[model samples]
Structures are given as C-alpha cells and as structure tokens.
Target: MAEKKFESDAKRNERLYVLYYIFGAMFIILLGALAYRQIFMYGYYHKKGMLQTQRRIIQPGARGDIYDRNGRLIVGNRPVFDAVVYFNDARFDFRKEYARLNKLRKQNKEPFDYSKLAIAARTNVLQSYIDEINSILKTDFVLDADFNRHFSGRQLMPLPLVKNLSISQHAILAEKLRVDNSAVQIYTDTYRYYPYADRAAHAVGYIRPEIEQVDPDIPGDDLRTFSFLGKIGKSGVEKAFEDRLAGETGAEIWVVDHNGFTFEKIESKPPRKGGSMQVSLDMELQGAIEDAFPNRKGAAVALDVKTGEILAMVSRPSYDPNTFFPTMTHAIYNDIRDRGAWLNRATQGLYPPGSTFKIITALAGIKSGVIGPDTVSYCDGYYQVGSRKFPCHNRYGHGEVNLQQAIEKSCNVFFYEHGQKMGIDSIAKTAKEMGLDSPTGIELHEESTRLTIVPTPEFKRKQGSGWSKGDTANVSIGQGDLRQTPLQMACFAASLARGETRTKPSILHDTTRKTDMKYHGAKKLDIPKSGYDAVIEGMVNAVERGTCRRAAIDGVKIAAKSGTAQVMVKGRKLTLAWMIAFAPVENPEIAAAVIVEGEEPGDASGGATAGPIMREMFAEYFKGRQVAQ
Candidate 1:
C-alpha cells in the first residue's frame, strides 16, 4: 500500500512541474507586452505626430513686361521678399510656451509687469530670429504691424520677409533659396511695377484684384493654375494685350512636413515666363504731351498720321498707377475714384466736336456740287433759320465771306448756307465714313456714338423727341446731335492726312498679332479735292493767323482748328475747350486732339485753354527742327 501511494505522488509531482512551467511562460509574455506598449506604441505615435511637416517650395510664374516702341520698359514686375509662415510647421504648444516663459520670468528678479514683459519678449523673439536670419544673409529684416496681423491670424502661414526688393536683392534671395537648405526658407514674390507711370498711366492702365479666375482663349493650359497669382492688364494697352502680358502658369509638387514646412520638391512643370510687350508709343513724345497741360483736366492723342499707329495719348488729371500692384487701399482707391481721375477720357469720354465738324459740312457741300470752294454767304451778325435767329459766336455777324475766308475765320454762316444747300443727310453720311459713328477699333476701351440725324417718325417713336429742322441746322455746326471723342478726332485728322477712310488707331503694337488694315467692305465717301484743299488751306490760315495762332511751331506748320462747345447746366452756359491739329501742313506726320471740360461758365474758349496745350507740346517737340528754309 505504501509503494502504491509513492507512485501516485510522483505522477502528481510531475504534473505540478509542467503546470508551473506553463504559468511562468505566460507571465513572461505578459511582462514583455507591457514593456513594448510603454516604450513604442502610444508615446512613439505622439512624438511622430509632433514632427513638423515639410513642404516643397513652389515658384510663382512671372508676368510679362510692357515696353514702348523703342523697347523701353513701361511696366514690369519686381521681386520682393516676404516672411512666410508654414502653419503646419509651427509649434502648437502655445500654453506650454506661455508657462515656460512665465517660469523664466518668475525665476528672474523682474517685477510682475505682464504687458511690458510680453512686448519685450515678442521683440526679443523677433530680434533673435532676425539676427539668426542676418547671420545667414547680409540684410536686415523689419518687423511691423503687418507681421503682427499675420502672426495673430495665421501662425502657420509664412509672412513676407521684405517687400519691394531690388533686382540685385531678388537675385540674392533667389540664389539663397535655391542653394540653402536651412530650416527657415525665403522665396521671391513679384509684384507689378510701373517705371513710367506718369508718362503712360492712361495708356497702360493699372491692375486690380480680379473677382475670379482668369481663363484665356488659348488651349493646352489651365488658367486656374494661377488662381492665386498676379493679374493681367485691366485697361489701356495693358488691358488690350492682357493675354500676351500674362504668361502660362506652371505648377509643381510640394511635399510638406507635419507643421507645413517646405521639404523636397518635385516639379510638375517649369512655368513659361510671360512674353514682353512692345507698343507703338514714344516715351519722349508722351512726356512732352503730358507737360503741355497745366492745372486743367484734358486729353490729347497723337497718331502717326500715315500708319495709324498711336504715338502718345495724354489724359490730364490721370491717377498714378504705381499703387495698383500687390494691393490698393480703399482710401487711395476712393481718392482716385471720387475725382474721376482713372477715366481714360481720350477714348472713353465724348464731347461736341464744335467748329471742327464744319470741315465735314464743307466736304459734303462740295461733294454735292451744291456749293464750291468759292461759295459766298452773307451774315447780318445773325442768320435766321425759319423763325429762330441763330447768333454767331462773333456776337457780330461775319458778313460777305467766301468759303476760304469763312473757313479761316470759322464763319458759321458759310457752313449753314452750304449745309442748307447739301442737306443734313449728306453731311451725316460724309462724317460717318470718316470713322465717326462707331469705335475706331483702337484696342483701347471706347464709347463711340452716332448722331440722330433728322430723327424720323420711327426714331421719334423709339425716342420721345420728334424731328425738328432747327435740330438739323444745329447739327450742321456741330451742336445739336454732335459728339466725338478726342481719339476719334485724332483718327479723323489722321484719315485726312492718309487720304483713305481706314481707321485702326491704338497705342498697342504687338508683332505677334497681325492687324487687319482693310476697311472690310466699307462704303467710301467721295469729296472734291478742291473743296478739301480749300478747307485745309483755311485751317492753315487759321493756325497761321486766326483763333489758333498760338499753335504755331517754330519748324513745323500745324494746320489746326479750335472749338468752344457750350453746355447748359442748371440754366448756366459752360464752355468746353477743344483743339485738333495735324503737323507739317502738306505731308502730316502726327495729328492730335485735346479737350478740357467744365470751363468757368463761358469764361474760357478752346483757343485760350486747349490750343495753348497744343502750342506747349509743339514748342517742346519741334525744339531744333527746321520746317521752313
């Protein structure tokens, strides 16, 4: 019995040993799992999340440059350095940082002055950062409210380092950005700049923030890629050649760190730099023309009388366009807006051609053979048309004047007599053919118009006013239904010089785009050479010895006409000054038109206001040229 008990106890001892071994193995496994969890799972993941994100720096494509006919830079883009903050790269432990700073302050003997300490701390931080930056770069960084604003709003986004950097500085920054792989990065951002802003602001209009994405007519590229980029031209030549001035935008892959910092970059495409623009403008002439006006609002356009290429266009009271790039403030914008300073008055504003329209009437009369160059008309100080007596501006009638004398003296009766003979329809038709009733297609924004000549019953139905013969008589002298722009007047003078009726006036001249010069199935207006010559001679006489006597140039002979259109505002008559001139008399090279509005209620005339501007322009331009031998 004892031996059997011993055997059972031995078997039980062996089972107990196996069970002990199994329990010891399980405990060792559990302890290893706990150690692994404590060392590498949750804690490791959090540390991994704390690492700053690295993003690849993206380069913005440059906008094209704008130049004059001589390739002088009119408008261009300049680089600027801006401090940029990568939100994702920024440390997010603001509370912990505040606590640490508080501990540092307490450890020192500094008093509890939170405001002063906070300011000093911020300044110290900025200074330290700038100092470190200066260590790498040999330039200084300025800290201002703009940085504060960006910091308060977007700590992750990078702030501008420097604005309005020079080309040399831009080169330095670009080279540093490409070569250096430091933790902090700086890149170049270009802003629109106008070097000759005073010279061609009206012709090369300013830019504004576009409301949305700009899509070009060209295929193979998406304009949306530049949705956050610089804008194209908005007005004048800039607006006209916006497509050319704005190049295709390219994009790249930017790998960012956890804190949104720039890391490695993969270029998706190399952005195509925009092409430069060359306009048909002479900067010297433009400056001379702008200097011609003094303290008055006016416009002048000079066109190559032979080629229809615009040389210079001046609009007075023009706003400077240098403030348009990057962004503009409401105060500055409203200052320009309230004064109508930004309006391109030359092409967009309309006014009466005044006495200048008499040339058309003379042509119409001579073309109808109803009156000759020697046609005579007598005025008794005032001519009676039906029941109304129309007074000449002379206040005393120009009596017994022939067409040449009438043109030289601008006698209203000669034109009235001829207008009566030829009828108003003939004059309207002739003027329309001279590029009047529509836009001249000048590549600039314009508001062109046609007169309501002899408003028929159908016209009366459309408009509330009925046709009146008195209106037709007024239209004959450029009064009742007469309106034309300074650019249109310039174009008209150019047509007379070129001797053909094609008009394509513009300040922009792009070699890439071909100009359609043919008038395109347009009707031609025929006039007698004798009549045209007589009137042109009369214009020459006027400039030489009449109302526009002040417009004489030393070397070149300028055939010119003056206009003083009357406007009735609140029962008061206001005169708008006007002048149109073409130089060299026989073979004109340039033609110009100028106008100034809101004259002191009939206190000013075209000869006194607009004509003198032409004189100033001529005096400066014809400085040493020889016209008469």
Candidate 2:
C-alpha cells in the first residue's frame, strides 16, 4: 500500500510540471506578439490613422493684372461674392435628418437604401437653408444639380448656393446673415474684369475655369484633397504667357474627425498673386483705331516705327470679354461664333495685299535694276500680258509718268509694266525679305506662318499649275495667290520706315528693347538712296494731292498708299480696301495698316474707306503726343 501511494504522488508531480511548461510557452508567445505590434507594425497603423484624420484643401492665387503701356488697367480682377454652405457645419443637422428619415422609413415598413436616404436627408436640410436665404435676401436660390455628387466626393469644400452677387445684394446678405459661425457664409472670389469693356479685348485675351492637382509644394499629398477651380488662359497673350501669369497655389491641412469633418486647422499657407505685366498697347490709341473701322468686318494695326511695339491692334466685331467671366452660356458663345468675332483679324485674316503691295513692287524693280528714280512708263488705261489685258483703276490713263508720278497717281499700268520686267521671282524675294511670308513673332498664339503666302513658281507648280505672266502681273498689283495679314503689312511698313528688311513685332513694353536684331534671316534693305527717296516722295505726294489725299492730317507730312483688291467670297465678288502708311516724312514715328471688307464690289475703295480711318488714327496719335509734350 505504501509503494502505490508514492507512485500516485510522482504522477501528480509530473502533471504539474507539464502544466508549468504550457503556461511558460504561452507567456513567451504573448510577449513576442506585443513587441511585433508595438515596433514593426507601428508605422503602418500610424499612416492609416493619419489618412483618416487629416485632409488637405488647395486654393488658387489671383491671376496677375495686365496693364497698358501708360499704366492703364486693361485686364484686372474684380471681387465677386458668393453664398456658400460648408457641409461640415451642417453635419449635426445631417445626422438628425437622417435619423428622422430612417425612423419614418422603419415605421412605414418600406425597404430603403442607406445612401439614397442619406442623400435625400441632406438635400432636404440644404433646401431649408436655401429657403431661409431666399426669404431674407428676396432672391431665388436653388440647389445645384450636382448636389449629391458634391456631397459624396467634395464634402470638405463649400458648395456655392448663389454666385456673382451685386454690391447691394452682397451688402444685404452680409448684414443679414450670421457669417462667423453659420454653415452658409459669404465667400469672396475673383473673376476677370475689363475696365474698358471691349477695348483691347483680343490682346488681353480671356480665361476659363480649370481644376489642377495639388502642387508638389503642398503637404499631405496622400490624404484626401479638395481643390478650388483656377483660371487658365484661353487665347491671345494670356495663352502665350501662361506660365508667367499663373499664380502660386496655396494649401491648408486640417485635422478631421471620424466623420471627415474638419475640427482643427493644423497648417495654412496663403496663396501668392501672379506676376504683373505691362503690355505695349496704348488704350487711347487702341480706342481711336477701333472706332475708325468703316465696317464690322475688318482689321487694323499700328506699330511704333522705331521699336516695332504694337501700339494698337483692332479686330472689329469684337466681344465684351467681361461677359465670359463668372460663366459663359451657350447662347452667348454661339452668337460670338456666328458673328465671326472669335477670329483675331489683325493676325489671322489673310487677304491679298491689294495696291498697298505696290510699295514692294516699286522697291523690287529698283533693287533688281529694272526701274530707277528716273524710270518712266506710259499708261493707256490697260497693260497687255500675253493675250489678256488687265485694266487700270482709271479707264483713261495718266499718259507718260515718272516713277514718283506713277506712285502718286497709283497707276497700275506702271507697276504692271515694271513688274513684268523685274519678273515674279524678284517681287517674291522682296516681299519675303519684308517679312510678309511669316508671322511677326508677336506674343500671340493665333499668329501663324502657314496662313501667310508669298507665292512663287515652285509654289504654283505644287498646286498643279504653272506660273504665268498674268499671274506675275496680278501679283505685281498685289493680287493672285499672294496673301498676307494686316499685322504683316503693318510690320512691313514699320520695317520700311526704319529702312530694315524685317520688323520683329512685340506686344511687351520694354524701353531697352533693340530693333537691330536680325529677323527671319533678313538683312538690311540695301537699295540705293535715290530709290527710297523716290518712293517716299511719291507716298508723300499721294497723301498730299493724290489717291491717298484723305489720309493727310492738317500739319502732318504723311507717306501713304491706298489699295483696292477684289476677292471672290462664297461665289460673290467683293472688294477689300487697304491703306498702309507712316507719319512725319522727316522723322517717322508710327506706321499703320488698315483693311476694310466691302459689302459690295464697287462700294469700297482704298481712299474712300481705309484712308479716312488712317487719318483718324494719325490724328489721335499726334493729339496724344501734343498733350504729352
């Protein structure tokens, strides 16, 4: 019996030992798991927690202001007021409404989608706020169609309830509403403003709303972000200087609660305004030139003779850029498009240079040794090129006329005779050398080289036709396939005034800018002094007592040329009246070009239409100079 009791005691001791080993192994496993979670998995959980609690908001800076050369505001920002609702401020109301709706649904025994119920509740709550706002402000306010989408995706940002409030309306709302702690607050934003309305509209350009991603400088990129819409350039100089004009982006990092509602602002950075710019446009001159357009469809450009600065650029049938801000409707856009107002005519309109191109023809004749100051040609109403006779503007000719007399009288027969003698290649060479074959390198994206044409023998061959003497004669008179923009013609005039082969136009204002820079591989016009003298004398005489007489200002000695070219538009023949000129034969100041599209074939002529406009431009320019002096 004693031996059996001792064996039982030993078995009991063995069981106790097994129990101790199991408890020790379990304690070790628990300690190991604690260390792993506390050290190795800490960063992962911390990041996940951060993502749920933090949110980022991005705001765009105000775009830079654009000014004229005389410090006049061309394009600037105007403060716009908006009534907006912050979703976070209405979170409690949202929850309360959701609970009430869910209870009602349960009592009715109707199946429900949680998302749909939530959306309906939010909409109802928001409608109540809108109703209150409407009652207080006496304005009709409605919820946007994208309310549900905004609630789902961009709850952190304020939703605009009413936008672009007038001064009185904004004042009334600010005085009536409790803005400090209310869900609905007055938000001040900026929209582009045109102080002069449609003046310099094309040069100033327009902007459209664009939503961009958060910049790299902003923090918490991995967190859910809300961005405000920013403006981007749509055309003109705005598009050309987009990078320089765009403002720096600002950011705010907020600590959000479990429901994605901002509770605390951790960091904030105010946006910086974009860089300001002063363009070369002179608004006073621009206005005068725009008002001088004879019709609704035409273009005019004026440049500083020495600097090639674009003083005035006018494309008629222009729009009020202010109408595009805040928002643009389909109707307004369609109207603008239908009226053909969207095109920048100064740089984009391609037309035959007309008789204005005679300047180049005369220069080419002189340069090619075919004609000189003493060269004389007789005109008997028409000139025969092969079997075809091209009629001059005067059915009765000026008899025998010298080079200067031919220009003064605008005798087409003289250019026709001399042009054929110089050949088409010489005229084309002179035209291209004058920068007529390419864009002027202005700070506008609308200017294109492809649209400009300086036709040649090879060019005609490519079009499946051979060059003809008739074509050359037509080209000599600035007809045929020779196409150029008003801007190009203005640049040519400016370059000629400076005695240079090319003029590189600029829209920026820089007093230190040089005009001696080579443009388009063009060199100085190396024609004889006598050649220039004859052309200038003829141009001056034309403005004083000849076809361009209307362009002459009282005390200003102007060198001018007038042109009337025929074109077939939509199977109807129309005339384009043209005038190109430079002022003060002694010291050139401004050079200009004007083109007017005629309603009928014979209704428009260079002197009758474009010459008067040129006179007005010169009048305005000298008037301003006198005031300054």
Candidate 3:
C-alpha cells in the first residue's frame, strides 16, 4: 500500500512540472510578441491611428482686383452670403435620430441596412434645419442631389444649403440665426463683380470654379483631405496673368472623431489675396469707343501711337460679364453663344482690309522704284488685267491723277497699274515686313495667325493653282486672299505713324516702358522721307477734302484712309466698310481702326459708316486736350 501511494505522488508531481513549463513558454512567447509590436511596428500603427483621427483642409485665397490705367476698378470681388451646415455640429442629432430609427426597426421586426439607416437619419436632421432656415428667410431651400456623396466624401467640411442670398435675405438670416453656436451658419465668400458691366468684358475676362487638392506646406500627406472651391481664369487678361492673379493656398490641420467629424483645429494658415493688376486699358476711352459704333456687328481698336499700348478695344455684340458670376445658367450661356458675343472681334475677327491696305501698296510701289511721288496713271472708269475688267469706285474716274491724287481719290486703276509693276513678290515682302501675315502678339489668348494671310505666288502654288494678273489686281485693292484684324490694323497705323515696320501690342500698363525699343526685330520703314511725305500728304488730303471727309474733326489735322471690301457669307455677298487713321498728323498721338459690316448690299460705305465712328473716337480722345491748328 505504501509503494502504490509513492508512485501516485511522483506522477502527480511530474504532471504539475509539465504544466508549469508549458505556462512559462507561453508567457515568454507573449512577451516577445509584445516587444515586437511596441518596438518594430510602432510607426505603422501610429500612422494608421493618425490617419483615422486627423485631416487637412485646403482653402483658396481671394483673386486679385483688376484696375484700368486711370485706377478705376474694372473687375473686383463682391461678398456672397451662403447658409451652411457643419457636419460636426450636427453629430449628436445624427446619433440620436439613428438610435431612434434603429429601435423602431427592431420593435417592428423589420430588416434594415445600418449604413442606409444612418444616412437617412442624417438627411432628416439636415432637412429639418433647412426647413427652419426656409421659414426664417422665406426661401425654397432643399437638399442638393449630391448630398449623400458629399456627406460621405467630405464629412468634415461645411455643406452649403442656400448660396448667393440677396442682401435682404442675408440680413434676415444673420439677425435670426445663431451663426456662432448653431448648426447653421452664415458663410462669406467672393463672387467676381464687373463694375463697368459689358464695357470691357472681353478684356477683363471671366473665371470658373475649381478645387485644389495638393499643398506642399501642409502635413499628413497620406491622410484624407477636404477642399474649398477656387476660381480659375478662363479668358482675356485674367488667363494671361493667371499666376499673378491667383492667390496663395491656405491649410488647416483638424482633429476628427471616430465618425469623421472635426472637433478641433490644431493649426491653420489663412489664405492671402492675389496680387493686383493695373492694365493698360482706359475704361473711359473704351466706353467712348464702344458707344461710337454705328452698327452692331463690327470692331474698333485704338492705340497710343508712341508706345503700342492699347487705349481702347471694342468688340460689338458684347455681353455683360456680371451674368457669368454667382453661377451661370445654360440659358445665359446659350444666349451669349447665339448672339455671337463670345468672339473678341477686335483680335479674332478676320476680314479683308479693304482700301486701308492701300497704304501697304503705296509703300511697296515706292520702295521697288515702280512708282514715285510724281508718278501719274490714267483712269477711265476701269483697268483691264488679262481678260478681266476691274472698275474704279467712280465709274467716270479721276481723268489723269498723280500718286497723291490717286490716293486722295482712292483711284483703284492707279494701284492696279502700280501693283502690277511692283509685282506680287515686292508687295508680299512689304506686307510681311509690316507684320500683316502674323498675329500682333497681343496679351490675349484668342489671337490666331492661321487666317491672317498676305497671299503670294508660292502660297497659291501650294493650293494647286497658279497666280494670275487678276489675283494681283484683287490683292492690290486689298480684296483677295488678304485678311487682317482690327487690332492688327490699329497697330499698323501706330507703327506707320512712328515710322516703324512693326508694333508689339500690350494690355498691361507701364509708364516706364520704352517707346522706341525694337519690337519683334522690327526695323525702320525703309522708305525715303519723300515717299512717307507723299503717302501722308495723300492721307491728309483724303481726310481734309476727299473720301474720308466725315473723319475730320475741328482743330485736328487727321491722316486717314477709307476702304470698302466685299465678302461672300453663307452664299450671300456682303460689304465690309473700313477706316484706318492717326490723328494730329505732325505729332501723332492716337491711332485707330474701325469696321462696319453691311446687312445688305450698298448699305455700308467706308466714309458713310466707319468714318463717323472714327470721328467720334478721335473727338473723345481729344476731348480736353489742346489741339494743334
């Protein structure tokens, strides 16, 4: 009996030892796992926790203001009022409503998706707030269609309930709502405002909303982020100076709860306004020129003859830029598009330069020694080229005219005779040297060089055709395959007045900019003083007692040329009336170009249509200045 008892005690002791050893090994393994997690995996788990609890928000800075040369505000920002709800402030209400709904579902023995139920509860709570706002402001506010997507993607940001509230409504909401502590708040944002309305709409341009996602200075690159809508330039000077006009981006580091609701902002940097810009446009001059247009489908441009700076640019059928802000509807967009108001006619509209191109022909003729100041040509109603007959404006014609008389009377026969003598190569060379074949390099994105052409034999040959004397006759009178913009003509007038071959136009204002600097490798006119004098004399005679009589102004000696060209549009023949001029002939100050499109045949003429408009522009420009007798 004693031996059996000893054996049982020994087995029991061995079983106890085995159990302790197993427990010891298990404890050691557990300690090793804890050490690995605490030491080696610290960074991974900490980053994951931070990503869940923290978020960064990006805010765009206000766009800069735009000013004219005279310091008048052309484009600026106006305060817009919005009614918004912060998701964080409504968290408790969301949880309570969700609990109530869940309980009701259970009691009714109905199956429901927890996520869907939560979303419904949130929507109901937001709707109740919107309803309260509607009662206070007498508005018809409702939840947006993308409310669920916004809630899921940007839970930490404020959702706008009613945007672009009127002044009266904004005041009512501000007075009745607890903006500081309530779930609903009044948020202030900016909308682009055009003080002058459509006066300089094309030059000032417009913007559209965009969101920025990346900011280098902000932390937490791997974390989720929320953003505010920012404006980006779409056209005109706004697009040209986008970098200078766009403001700096700001950031906020926020602490969020498990439900992704922001509870505290630990760090923040407010956005700064963009740099302001002062353009070379003169609003008063711009307005005056626009009002001077006699027709609705035309363009006019004025420039400072000394510096190539644009004084005024007018494109008719203009739109009120104010309509584009605070949200543009498809109706307004369609209306603008239908009216053809979106085209900047001054820079984008291509047309045959008409008689205004006579200036180029005269220069080419003189430079090639094909004609001189004393040259004379006989005009008896028409000139024959090959088998075609080109008639003059005056059927009977100016009997026998000198170079000066030919220009003063706009005798087409004289140019046809001289242009043929000079040949197409000399004419094309002069035109290209004058920059008629390229864009003016203005500070606008719409300027294109594709349609602007100074057609030559080479150009015609590439089109699988041969050049002819009829083509030369057509080009000599500025009618065939020769197209230019109003801005280009205006620049040409300025360059001619300054005795230069090219003018680089600019929309920015700089008083210190050199006026005599070479532009795009521009050189002097390369014509003798006698040649320039002859052309100037002819132009002066035209304005004083010739075709451009209507362009004459009291106490102002103007050098001007008028033209009438033909075009076929939609299978209908139309006329384009044009005028190009520079004022105070001896000391040129302003250069201008104007064009008027005819609605019917013979309805428009250079002197009858475009001359008066040019007169008005010059009258306004010399409004308060002393004029040379």
* Per-prediction TM-score: 0.76, 0.94, 0.94
What shift in Å separates residue 377 of candidate 1 from its native position after superposition? Answer: 0.5
Worst 10 residues of 1 by lDDT: 218-227
Misplaced by over 4 Å in model 3 are 1-36, 103-109, 179-181
- Error (Å) of candidate 3 at residue 429 is 0.3
lDDT of 2 by residue, 1-629 (tens): 99999999999999999889999999999999988988999998888888999998999999899999999989889999998889998888899999999999999998988988998899998998788779888878887878878877898899888888889988988877865345678899999888988777887788898895578988887888999999899988788888888889999999988877889999999898899898999999999888877655899999998788999999877999899868889988999999899988899899998999999999999999998999999999999988999999999988998889998999999999999999999999999888888768887898856778998999999999999999999999999998989999998888788777887888999887755645334477879999989999999999989999989888788999999999998888999999999987788999999999888768888988999899999999998454211
What local lDDT does model 2 show for residue 121?
90
Model 3 global lDDT (CA atoms, 0 to 1): 0.88
Going through the candidates in order, what is the number of backbone clashes in each?
Answer: 31, 0, 0
Q: In model 2, which runs have C-alpha deviations exceeding 4 angstroms?
A: 1-37, 106-113, 179-182, 517-522, 624-629
428: Cα error in model 1, Å: 1.5
lDDT of 1 by residue, 245-348 (tens): 77565544444454333456544655566788778888888888787776667788888775678888887788777776567889888998887787777877
Q: What is the C-alpha lDDT of each candidate?
A: 0.69, 0.88, 0.88
